[model samples]
Target: MLHQPAAPVGKDPAQQYKMRLGVWMVIAYSLFYGGFVAINLLKPLLMEKTVLAGLNLATVYGFALIIVALLQALVYDAMCRAQEHKLSDQKIAGEVR
Candidate 1:
């Protein structure tokens, strides 16, 4: 017995859009993350200052990094889905016409 995929898979129409979006998001995230590293290196004592709710800069920035990554992931997912939907609709429209 052989197993088969539920849906036929082929080339992705949104490949280019996905790649471009992914790369830009990565660069944006890297820059944001780099700021944290820069502060730690250049101004190590600055991390001890309380920023919010008595949380030190290190604690706050650490948590912010996690939250930002999750938010970025959500944004990336939504954008990719929108692009895929747009391309899929165009393909369907072309097929109908």
Candidate 2:
């Protein structure tokens, strides 16, 4: 016996938008992360200095990176969902006409 997918997978109309959005987001995140690496490479001692709440620069920056990543993921998801919804509505409206 052969099994089939529950629903047919159609090509995403939001593919291009999603790809562009994703690439931009990745580049933004990479630039932010690169700063951390630059600091470590140029001034290793700077990481030991307390920046906030008695947390060292490295610790604070590391935590901030994690938070930023999570925030970016959420924002990306919201934007993609909105784009997909808008495109889907347009497709439906087109079908009705």
TM-score of 2: 0.90
lDDT of 1 at 42: 99
**lDDT of each prediction vs. the true structure?**
0.95, 0.97
| Model 2 C-alpha lDDT per residue in residues 20-66, reported as the tens digit of each score | 99999999999999999999999999999999999999999999999
What's each prediction's clash count?
0, 0
TM-score for each of the candidates: 0.90, 0.90
Which candidate wins on lDDT? 2
Candidate 2's C-alpha runs over 4 A off are 1-8
Poorest stretch of ten by lDDT in candidate 1: 1-10
List of clashing residue pairs for candidate 2: none
